[model samples]
Target chain A: MATAAARTFALSAPLPLDNGQSLDGVIVAYETYGELAPGKDNAVLVCHALTGDQYVASTQPLTGKPGWWERMIGPDKPIDTNRFHVICANVIGGCMGSTGPASPAPDGKPYAMRFPVITIRDMVRAEVALLDGLGIERLHAVVGGSMGGMQALSLAANFPARAERVLAIATTARHSAQNIAFHEVGRQAVMADPDWQGGDYYGSGHSPDKGLSVARMAAHITYLSETGLTEKFGRNLQDRDAKSFGFDADFQVESYLRYQGSGFTRRFDANSYLYITRAMDYFDIAEEHGGKLADAFAGTPARFCLVSFDSDWLYPTAESRHVVHALNAAGAPVSFVELSAPFGHDSFLLDVPALDRVVKGFLA
Target chain B: MATAAARTFALSAPLPLDNGQSLDGVIVAYETYGELAPGKDNAVLVCHALTGDQYVASTQPLTGKPGWWERMIGPDKPIDTNRFHVICANVIGGCMGSTGPASPAPDGKPYAMRFPVITIRDMVRAEVALLDGLGIERLHAVVGGSMGGMQALSLAANFPARAERVLAIATTARHSAQNIAFHEVGRQAVMADPDWQGGDYYGSGHSPDKGLSVARMAAHITYLSETGLTEKFGRNLQDRDAKSFGFDADFQVESYLRYQGSGFTRRFDANSYLYITRAMDYFDIAEEHGGKLADAFAGTPARFCLVSFDSDWLYPTAESRHVVHALNAAGAPVSFVELSAPFGHDSFLLDVPALDRVVKGFLA
Candidate 1:
């Protein structure tokens, strides 16, 4: 069943960004599950990943697909929306009913490349504005995974009083060189597409689908564990007894990745992909707080719970331990665990019973 | 100090391929170093990796750069060219003077996508033909790393008596699902470019350089270890005091990757990249030998040495161990070592002093 209708809230004033620019007339699109308590103390904010939107426990409007975290957000699920109000919003540089590069500028044209570059902290500022408009000065918990995990950490660090408990899964406080390198490849792929037309392809009939698909294909590989891929596809042929000795998808894994890539282009905007990835690349909480991670959590009252998947090379358990060590140095209440999973960085979005238990227990 | 000039040998007959097809009028491009023994037993056949050429111990004509294995070859080096006759051949699908997609087809046009797909064994077959042309009955050794390693393994498995020793470094006997997935991404990136023109970019004035650059960028990341990247580039800015808040290469890693991507497009052919990577993905010695790896090495008299880098996730030590186990099962003499190096799959190409000793001792 459809869980909740999408809602939007416009900030009364410009939202200040880390890049020394202000985003004007910003509108945050969000979805809520369950009801807010009378004291507004039972509100939980769930941030989405790089490509995720606001359909936390409902069907996505564009793809008619179930919410990314549908398995963990319903009644009696890990998130347990019946017990607490759950809110999820599309990030600022996103395209899903949010103010982003696809939004119209003062000239009544899509901002396209003119969209101000954003950072993880800038996204949090927009989220905080949304929270302020909702009359919720504090969240019972701020929870996320991947890019969302970055946001969870950002809110806890920047707006220390906004979240009482923070749960960040499979994430890092700083984007590594490898991470930036991968993102740069994707960006270059999109920009290289003739159809991208300098990111001004809003109504040009043709978009950088080919390049975006390639970008998605590359990113999809990072989301999966080598063991998981070997177990699922191996050297299996793609419905052929012998290789066609051509450029076609001969291996099942190749076919699967191609499908993943092409399907992604149908629902994503190339410009938004660029903007979001740039935001992630600029994320460095330690650097933001005078180059000391411990200083980022100083005087924060939030109880932090960090979870990592063993197979996630993108944001490995070592990154989580780094954060935990910093929290320890900051004398903050923090709990950390590296759960075993074969899904890599996508484990948080996949069916991992251990992750479900961790989320449920941490929230409780 | 010019080691040798390139030479080409035309196969006397059509070359039989693994896909039941035949390649006609094939020409193998190669180079030689040092003097051949009167008995020809001092001959060493070196197989170059993807994107490498026959300029093994000389300056590459196209880029004016020293050979890929320059440090490991030449007089007094580990391979000791002064004491052994070294021969390196560009593979069939390569872009050098070899017969490849860029070469003229039967109709006097570039083969483009019409070129038949090749396998690692097919590549070994070509090398065997080159040896036959040179009047060499057997090789003192067959040496390679990465895709080159695949060819060395193929030579040992398919032509057991042709080589007295086989040295394979930082490679796998079979392309894992992850390996195939990454290659597939690179392939898709190339094909997505309009300039690719279905691999018919030859003589088209413009090539799919953008797409190939993106592909190279992605592959470049897999070549380096995370720890190495952190130590080399980290989140350091690129000649700047602050973030640019734009799509420019603000991070040093991004700038480095961009330079690498652009510089590669100059000296490489996109169509050759597609064909070579395809050959690599199709590599599966176990499958080629009735689903048993040991069967591939059955009765092989060659002494084998397999080297892997501890940080090489692309083709980790486990893959080498698998080959070693199979060699043991076949009662073949085999030695394997996983050297501690931070360079990942590129460790074999980098300066790792331990590797030099191992290669010298193995060849001796």
Candidate 2:
């Protein structure tokens, strides 16, 4: 029964946008855990971060690895699939099984750079259409962190009646100056790779893996705190006592980052990284609502819980406080907390029993 | 008169270190301005940052351009070469005619990767030897900014009595976790290039230009701030009205970074980048001095002035405050101020009239 419970579904449908341009032939690669309640009021949607896909509660087809949110989506975990129906889908402009830059263009070749430049709100729109096609109206909660949290907020603002509760963690309502600078560096790294060939490497028997890896490695450092890195790496030599006195990966942290970068290239499309990170950078909830953040949630009834980490310089506690202040000004019921975590901006993905308790309690 | 002013002496010497190892046959590519006052007491040493060389007060030979510190060293500017006998040398482990990975090995081949792993202290030792060879017993001031600032601090701590004053700006006493992580990313970018070939690309006739460019681009981002970046390039299209919907550097910032990266590779050795950044990451003044930051300056009579830029996040005001706190604890005569500058971490290199006034007053 457990084996049969982890089923994925393929849904190809059109998602109409307010801009009058519809995303045609959209394919939603999604997985669901547990069963929808009789009233369909216990449904929960879990959005994924940049580079993440639909395998939030199942194994990934590409890497054959467990879902990225496995720690917080099992039977006894925070989401508690045994008590609630959980749904997660690959976002638009992603490189997984979903529609993305690596997908075929109208000419039948890989889209490469031809894919439309999409925003975080566009991804949420597609997800909402998928939910509509599935004949399931989300009634319980919308929960996500980082870019996923951006989608959660988008959902709450754009479709207030869709969810009863919203949980956003380690997220910013708008990309900060520091965030944009780091993302720009990553984008430059990808573009500098000669193999990239103007992002047309699909049929060239080569990928811009090196540049993408460097970009990933650079971005990865921003996701962690200074203390976390020092505690983990601490100038520790890699596979030797003294320095190699040469240019090998002389430090363990270097080796770890290289592994992360290289492994990432195998599973991700460089163009997708470019598109997704741009979407995140362009995300500005207030800009969408006439430079008034409160207007985005003016009449929203969704109970909100926002969490940030002390060590997260990427989206520091101040960012979360700004969001909370907007929610308060809008007369929306909101609870905010800054938790102590040494993991920096990536604390949402790490082990934090406090976050787990908070999510569980808020959902209940 | 101009020829007489340009006349310089070459000093090649050996530097002995506390570790019993010595850098033999060291070549100090140096340039001096003005005249050393009687007793050589008015001499000032200006160290350069990574990728910087000598010619601090003269036209550079390789680029045929004005010196890097031209703004700070000219008449009526800070450090006032007209008032002090200013000396700037290509640092050890650098490629600007100094002993570095690109230099010839004992066996007549380019050292490539065979060069000894040199630290900041090793660099200071070599500079000390150069000063001795020049018949300078003590310097009125040792001045530098950024990596040059690190060298200035090292000189103050390691060879305290050699200088009466030290000016360290926009620098840190130790590399933070984030600093190390960024350096590691840069190192990986270089090694990932196949042309790097274990740092033996000398005779192979192939330079790891791509890798080195990416590394430089990444480092360049850190040397800037988000505010500075946005003000400079705010999602502006590159030679187009709209996005090409392709990956050809859609933004002006991307194009700028690419230019910086490519230009840097033509002048710098990739191996030197790896070596120097590693040495910087390994630098911890407190760790080197019994885990007591004050002990590094204890009993040292060197006057200190630490300057920081308000918008410089790479080495923020907090980092300068930490150093100032340590200096205070050591009873060192120190002057500290955070200058308001929009140029971010690169403000020291930019035209900041306030910085010039402070430097002139402090050095005087």
Candidate 3:
């Protein structure tokens, strides 16, 4: 079951999907750091979030920006690539090299809207196939933050024996109604743009950059805490002493958000955004276990560590506590901590030394 | 100074706006309830928020909807139009019957993109002129919530002798970074729509309803509590038992948000949305008073009552406390309470008995 390292694997076998369809020619793009020790006992799987790619410790090919989790995955970082083998994969519906809507179908055309809708479980299944090919069944740990945390937790629940340690940060066991609502806002923005053209804009003259920019701008606000935005840019005008009294990016926050939106459209695809957000909204772990959260982790032997930020109202500590209570009911050993950080849900990716200590201690 | 009641006042006198521009032929549309009584002592000023109009206790002509604040008005309601002459005006930057972006400019064209940006204080200034024309030397109370609450606080701070009592509910003395961020998202959504046509869509036979709807959907999520949305539409599918596996409004939350967005587009003007949101982003009472919130109300003589909802993270109880501290330091007699309501920031517009009782008692 050993496959080539840092390469794309195409599973030609038909795989069952949650929505009564079977996918063929599934391609999973992945990157591995460090070496798989003898017996593969030192292998640690890292699950990336919605927009993240397999380039966990290197520059992103699309934008040349540093890898999203580079701060936490370097040689001497908490993840400690020097000591353990780390594997990261771009999820199936991602715009990266993964087999997504942008990927070719068996008929040699972009799947686009023809691509099968995927769930968070489906994304995990694709990753698990990658794991299968790596010849690594039982490993050290599964770690992720935000949507990545969802993947890690999913691995622990669905594949109980895959990892001995599970660390999920700034995530929820389920997407809240507000979570779905915000994602829907993004989808609507993308769809409302005529350039989107029902997700068939591939090879078009221009992509739906305006619509994608709006979507990114809306979603970006939810990532950071209100306090963070204020301390960074509060009522400060962009470049004028007096108010312009017209519809220009007057406030510095507006300019910053506009820049973020426009910059995101250059690297991301609009149709991929729609598909991935739908997958997140469809995520409900308890529903997968007959409305019992405890049942989702019942009889699991993996030790769990849950982390939340003090200011992350998006997936608040309350959501983490819900999962912790279920783990407690399931009779599993677990440790939970709510760290103080002003960056809200994005704290896991930021410079939080406390998070580093927590990750190091939990892994140890 | 004596003008007619329950009518529109065309003030040909030049009015200086905050943005170093003078506005001429300012038309303020307002409605009055009950009688002003002799000496005009029983006159009460009730300000409306972002999308509200002068029809606070009457019927809205555009959507055939009831008055926005009918719950707090009426004979035995909190504000009690039975005893006091309650006056509500569509703000200067509003659509409705007010002279706003949709109104004709001096050049005989819809102002559209040419409309000057106005602040919450500018809205208050327009209302103050309406009061001056009505021969009302002083008001019994100035009451508002959300943006309306900003106006109430602004009136108390700027014209200390204009009102005997001030009540601000479900609002902050200044817009938070998150508040401004959310408004910026909406603004970006509108501007991103090519149909917006650089804000000159008045006579184009089509407006940017799609963009405006996306903006409303984003803002509507902020109005309701996450708990409320979870309780109302938690992963419940819309007219289906199984997943659609396509990008339709599968979840009830998506359907609900889409309906909210589309319904809002029918009644609201897109250009006015841009202008009003700009004004709200410009709101900062402390910044107006050299960094001290207390200094904003230092010489105010009006008794104040500040109310906040416990679940409203949008404005939050902490924001109300900051204003209360300022009021206390200003030597203004202030009453403050945090009411428990599941409906987040929109609680002020709903039938929360606690809020009704608080308003009644304070006004009494």
Candidate 4:
């Protein structure tokens, strides 16, 4: 049945960060599926996006929903977990049982806003610690989409010997100005809520649900394509024959957005959202490597496969192409494709048959 | 000097709305530049966008800044005041001295949430009343961009004999799902504010400034092209050499957005934003005309001119093309042009010289 059980690993050493700070006693929460080969060479690491946890092929305890990539990671599925051991871990700034903002500090108090800012590379460092803990010296492949793709690329670049194959989908090498701007709006929405109480709302009986919901609503729009929204909702009334002439959710799209916004608050923490989005905004492999993106992957041993969606404007095909150019300059073996999809950036997580083919072929 | 003096007019009768409700004692704020001419044949009506007021060719009283479209509407510029009389009016649901949510109702209390939902056609009806009060039947041309373009199209569709020419720039005949979704996010942000107090916070020594600021920030990003933002603010640090590692606007883009959000709350009303955005979301000339946009302009006398900016993703060139197709099907005299500009949807208001030339030639 390949039912995965959640596990947590506390690091034996402090994890260093690019921001000149170190997180002490870091705990990484992860889930594993399939059986590990005796030689331990058939391992594959799967990364999750902004709001994802490490429930890879299991059910989420909070929402009782299937793991985000369950369709692609089951036995004989595209990822083919029967032949490959799969591991997925929660990022450091994430709130999914990992040592995050909601975790206790040295004083046994919730870190809340006092948690040190961490970068994408810092997240990779924590992942590397998890890999070390698992005693897997090298993985057959590391796969991800969206922010997950950033981690896959980060693994390939910063820790060259960690994985043999790197598959990144609908991701960018660096956050664009528009990307930073959008994340900033989300952060502002979260901070603006009076219930936020400067991120000290932990155990307050009242959370910044309204602010987080607004933040989620603003961000949720960016994940879907304009055409998709038009096709799905298209000015259709929510539940009435005519407009309510009031502030009630009149349009189907508005109703859907409100649902997405309110629903997100139940499973996500506002402070963790702030930190993760900031890390994403600070992500710039080129900046980290003397302003030359090619230098980030210099003499890399990993073979790279990059996939972008034609409708994904959040991280368009141009971004993938830019990364391809850098890989080419670095003399790395790489392949790229821009698959057609109607779901925009969310196409990575949606049912895109071509994506399945690409992932399967790349991992093989 | 082509300085426009602010003026206001009270409608002698009630203003009818599409929502089966009428507003009594409606007031419209306006500004006029140059002379009306002996025959009033040289008069030109200019409609303002959502955030725009009646300060077309004058300094804004609230901020002491030049009028938004001053460069395009001066004595010698396009829509030249020397050659024609120009009048600009604040939409009835606007906060610039117009009868909006902030205005008093028959009970002598602010309308607040009690303001009747208005449509673009209803706004034109108020403009028509204002024109009648001035004893001038619209001649020459009516020009607008964005939401103003919606009003221009509405005037041509409903009051076909009011204007000889209609110039709609960077706009659409109907709001797309994406458009409505973005506006919904903004509205939600405002309504989520604790200080909103169910829209009755007026004179309470506090307003939903944070919520309204967040809304403005979200909208401001849509106003510019991705390329423009990259070129202007890329990942540059904000007045510092390195990231602050804290949530204090480390990036220049974040600083810019925060500044914009905070600054907007100073000169704009929160409830008015809600009302105006609602009106825009409800705009669909085709829906009002038996699901055929061509039918909206049937038997129209005005010559139509539509200009779209190539980089505008908000109301892209495709939207203008859609309107042109409808106008073509209706056998209307319409000229369409896609101008190359890096500013995106705000191209109509920015220094897009091609737009200035088009406005001049079309009006001439």
DockQ: which candidate is best?
A: 1
Q: Write the per-residue lDDT of candidate 2 for residues A1-364, one digit (tens) a residue.
A: 1111333344465566433466677776677887788887888999999978878867777798877878888787889878988888888788777788888877889887767778888888877876787676865999999999999999999989899999999998988655766787788678768788888999899998988999999999888887798898876768896555455677788888889999999999999999898888778898788989999999998899999999997888888999999999999999999999888889998898899999999988
In the order shown, the chain A TM-scores of the predictions are 0.99, 0.96, 0.97, 0.99
Give lDDT: candidate 4, residue A294.
98
Task: Return the TM-score for each candidate structure.
Answer: 0.99, 0.89, 0.97, 0.99
Candidate 1, CAPRI quality class derived from DockQ: high
- Judge candidate 2 against the unseen true structure and give its global Cα lDDT, from 0 to 1: 0.83
lDDT of 1 by residue, A1-87 (tens): 327877999999998988787988999999999889999988999999998999978999899999989898988898887888999
Candidate 1 residues B103-195, lDDT tens each? Answer: 999999999888989999999999999999999999999999999999999999999999999999999999999999999999998988999
Question: Model 4: how far is B305 from its true place, Å?
Answer: 0.1
Candidate 1 displacement at residue B284 in angstroms? 0.5
How high is each candidate's interface RMSD, in Å? 0.6, 3.1, 1.1, 0.6
Task: State iRMS for model 4.
Answer: 0.6
Query: In model 2, which residue pairs have backbone atoms overlapping below 3 Å?
Result: none
Candidate 3: pairs in clash: none
TM-score of chain B of 4: 0.99
lDDT of 4 by residue, B254-285 (tens): 99999999999999999999999999999999
RMSD of each: 0.9, 3.5, 2.8, 0.8
Worst 10 residues of 2 chain A by lDDT: A1-10
DockQ-superior candidate, 2 or 4: 4
